[model samples]
Target: MCETNHNHNIKLDKNGNCNTDEHKTWNRRSFLQALGLVGGGSMMLANTPLSVSRPSPLSIALSQSTNENILVLVRLQGGNDGFNTIIPVYDYDVYANARPLIRIPPSEFINLSDDYAMPKPMNKLESVWGEGQMKVVHGVGYENSSLSHFKGSDIYANTNLQEDDRTGFMGRYFGEIYPDYFFNPPPSPPSLQIGSIGNLIFKGPESDYSFAVSDPRRLLQIIENETFYNLDGVDENCTYGEKLRFLREATNTTFDYAEVISAAYERSPEYTDSSYQDDSLGRQFRIISRLIRGGLGTKVYLVTLGGFDTHNNQIQRHQQLLTSFSEAVSTFYKDLAADQSEDWAGRVLTMTMSEFGRRFRENGSLGTDHGTAAPTMFFGPALNGSGFVGEHPDLNNLTRGGNVTNTVDFRQVYATVMKDWLCVDEGLVGRSLLDTDGGPFESLDLGFNCSGTTSNIPSDGESLSHIPTYSDSQTFINIVTPQTTHIDVSLYNIVGQKVATLANEMLMEGVNMVINVKDSANTRLSTGPYVYQIKTNNGDYSKSIIIS
Candidate 1:
C-alpha cells in the first residue's frame, strides 16, 4: 500500500519553512524575467526545425512513472451512440442496414482490418491505434437498464446507482489517498462548466480537486489577482462574502500554477491544429493538450462533447459531434507522441462515455429513442490494449422498446481503473464511493471469486451479501468476462435514495441488461449512506459501490 503523507505541504521552500522576502523577490523577478524573455522573433525561431527538441524551461520536474498514470476522462454528454463513433466495418453491412440514415458506410470508415474501423472523422485515432498504444472497450453497460438520458447519465457518473453518494468514485480515492491540507485549498474564480456543471467523476469531500476551466489561459489570470488573493473582501464575515473570498484565493493559485504550464506548451515545437469543427469540445481538447504539454500537475482531468441525445436528427448531429470528438482526440494523441515524453506518453489515458445508449431498433423519426445498452469506448495507455472488455448483450433479448440487454457492470471498469490503473489501494478507495459487490457484477461472468486472487468474472449474487473483508473504499469485484462488447454497461452514484423503480418493463427472457449512469463534476450528491441498484429484464438487483 502506498503510504499517505498527511503532512505534505505545497509551500514554496523545500525546508518546510516560510519563504523569505528575498526569496519572494527572487520568484517575482524570475516570473517577470521569464515573461520579458518571450520575444516574437524567438517564438518563430523556436517554432522552426531548430527548436524541436528543447522543451520549455518552465516545465515542472515530474516523476515520469507516476505521471504516466494520468487519467483523462472525456465525457460525451447527451448520450454518445458508440455504434456510430466506432463503426463495425466488418459488421457495417449489418449496422448500416440497421440505421441507414445514421450509418457511416464501410467505404467511409478507417478500417483496422479486423472487422472494425473508426469513423472517417476519427482518422487521427486510427493512426494511433496502429501504434499498439490504444485499446477499445466495446458494448459496455450494466444489466437491466435502457436509455433514459437523465437516469442513465446519473448512473454512469455515480458508479453506484445510489442517490446519496455524496462523493464520487474518483473523488473518494483522491480524498483517501491524497488527503487535502485545509490550510492550502484550491484557488478559484470557479471556471465555467463548458459542457455542463462538471461531471460526478471529479467530486469529493476533501479539498476541491477538480476545476472545469473553460479557458485556463484567461481564468488563471483572474484567480491570481491580488484583489482575489486569500479571497476575503471587505465583507469577509458574510456567507456570500466568505464564499467569494475562497474563490478568489483558489483562482489565484490555480492561475499561478497554470502560468508555468502554459509556458511549457508555448515552448513545445509540436502544435496541434484548432481545426476539426472549431466547437466547444474541439477547443476543450485543444486546451487539455496545452495543459498537459505545459507540465501542469493535474492528475485527473475532465472534458465533454455533447449532442448525442439523438431522439431526432440522429444522422446529421451524431455524425458531426463524433467527428469533432474523434478529430480532436486524435490530434491530441498525435501531439503527445511528437513531444517524445514517452514517460508522459503512455501516462495519459482517455475514456469516452454517455448517459445511456439508444434503443436497438430505430424509431419512426429515422432516429432512435432513449434506450439502454449502447457501446462505450476506453482507449488509452492503461487499458489492457486492443480488443474489448465485457460481453455484448444479445440484441434479440431486449426490453419492450428494443433496448439491447447488457452483460457487464459499469462499476467493474471504474474499479479496474481505480485499483489497477491509478494504483489506488482498494482500501483507500472508500466503499462509500463504489460498492462493486452489489449491482450488475454479481451476475455477470466477470470471474470475480472474492477468493484473494483477482479474477475478472462477476460474482454470484449471494457473494455480494458479504461486507467486504477489506476496506470498502478500495475493494473491487473481480469479474471474469471478455473486455469487448456490443452493448455497454455504465455505473452512477445515487445519493441515499432507495431503489424506487426496480420493476423490469417485462421483456423477453434469456440475458439480463444493466444500468447506465452519469452525474455532475463538483459537489456531493447528498449527505447520507446510499445503495446502487441495477434494474434488468429479469428484475432489479443492487449492492453497495459505496456505503457512505
Candidate 2:
C-alpha cells in the first residue's frame, strides 16, 4: 500500500495543506530540521521507543483527589531581573547602592505594604492587588542552579538537573492524570502553549501531550489546502523515509488540532477595550482567555513571552516587557471577569516562570547578567494572591558572583499547585516534578480554598539565618542541642492549631541541625499569620513564621 510520491509539478492552493496527496512527503523532514523542533518536541527521534515503561495514567484521579483547578503557566524566556521588577522596600538603600543606574526609583514604584514594592510599570495591577489576587513568592530557585539559558530553563522545565532530559514537569503531571491521552484525548489538549511548540513541558513518555502550531492561521492555511506532508506509504526500509512517515503521521494528528484551535479562535470576541496592548504577549493572552471562556477543558495552559534577557539597554527594554506583561495579565483577568464570563475569574490561577533571575548587582552594560534565585508570582481571584511569600531577598549578602540566594524552592510552588490546586495525587507529584532527587516536594500553602477548607500552613520565618539562605526553597528551623536530647519542632497558627511537625528526633550533644519547614494539607497553614515551637530536654525555643 506504500508508494513514493516525489515533488513534481505539485499543485496546491494558498493554504499549505496537501490537497491531492495527504500522505506523501514533499521534503517534510527538511522543513522540520529548519525549525529545530524535532529534538525539542519529539526528543530522541530514533533512539527512544514509541512507548515507555510506566503505570497506566488512566486512574490518576483517585477517590481522595481534590477538585480540578485550572493553571495558566507563563514563561519569561530570557532571565528576568527580579530586583528591578520587585523593588526591595525593606532594603532600598542597599538595593539602590547595588544598582544605582538600573535601580527603580522609590517614587516610581507601587509599594506592596511596607516590606515590598513593584516598579510603576506594574502599577496598573493595583486592582489585582486590591482584590488580594496578587501573590509574590520571593526568592525562587534551586541548588546548583545554572546560568546558561538552555541549562537553567531545562532545570526548571525538567525540574531535574539532568542534561539529557525531554520529560517536563507539566508533561509528567498531566501524563499521569490522563494516562489514556494518546488513545483517548481530552476534551481539548490538556495543555496548550500559544507560541512555539518546541517546549518539552507537555512532553509524555511515548508521545507529547500538547499541540504545536506557530500560528493558527498558518496551520489553517496548511490544513485548508489539504497539503498534508505525505510520507509515500513510508517504508520502514528507508530510515529517513520511515522517520518522515512517523512525522507525517504526527502531522496528520496536528491537522486534528488545527480545526479545534480555529473553532476556539472563532468563538473568542475581538478586544475593543484600550487596556489590552497591541503586542504579541497581549495577543497570546487574548487567545488563552477566549479558549478558556470557550469551555476548553484544558487543565493547564502555557503562554511564553521572551525578551526578558536584558543584557544591554535594559531600562527601556525591561520596562516595555514588564509593561506588556502586567497589561496582558490585568487585561486577561478583566476580560474573564466581564459579564460574559464572570465565574472564571477565580477559577483560573495565573503563575509565571523564568529560566533564572538576573544577577543581584547590575553589570557594566546598565543591565543584569544571568544569575540564580529570583521572584515568581501567582495571580488570580481565588487565591489570596496578595502579600509576599517566602524569605525576602537579602541584598547585603550576595552569593557566587552577586546572585540572590533562593528562599523558596520553585518545586514547592508546583507541588502546591498540583496537590492543593489541581488536586493531583501525591504519588504523581513525586513522579512528575523533580525537586530533591525526585522528591514529593513539601506543598506550599498558597491560602487557596481548594475544597472549601481553611489552610493553616505557617508562613515564612524571618529571623537571623540559622542556615545561610541557599537557593533551595526550604525554610530552616535551627536547633542547637546541648546534650543528648530528644526534640520536637511543631508549627502552629496564632489560634493554637498544631499545623505541622518539621522534625521529631533525638540529637547528640553539642550538635546543631537546620530543619526545613513547608506547609501542606495535613499541616495546613494559612497565609495570614502563624507561629512555631520547638520542645527539647533543655527547654522550649519558639520562633514565628509569616506564611503569606
Give the number of the best model, judged by lDDT.
Answer: 2
Model 2: per-residue Cα lDDT over 444-467, one tens digit each:
767774566322221123211223
Q: What CA RMSD would you report for each candidate?
A: 17.9, 18.2
Instruction: Give residue 496's lDDT in candidate 2 (0 to 100).
Output: 42
Query: Which prediction has the highest TM-score against the true structure?
Result: 2
- Where model 2 places Cα greater than 4 Å from the true spot, the runs are 1-68, 183-187, 210-254, 270-274, 435-439, 452-548
**lDDT of all the models against the reference?**
0.48, 0.65
Give the per-residue lDDT of model 1 (tens digit) for 18-123: 3322221122112322443211111111111100001111111110113235667777777766666666565455566667776777677687666667777777
* Candidate 1: stretches off by over 4 Å: 1-67, 88-101, 113-115, 181-183, 186-195, 206-270, 274-277, 381-385, 430-432, 436-548
TM-score of candidate 2 relative to the true fold: 0.66
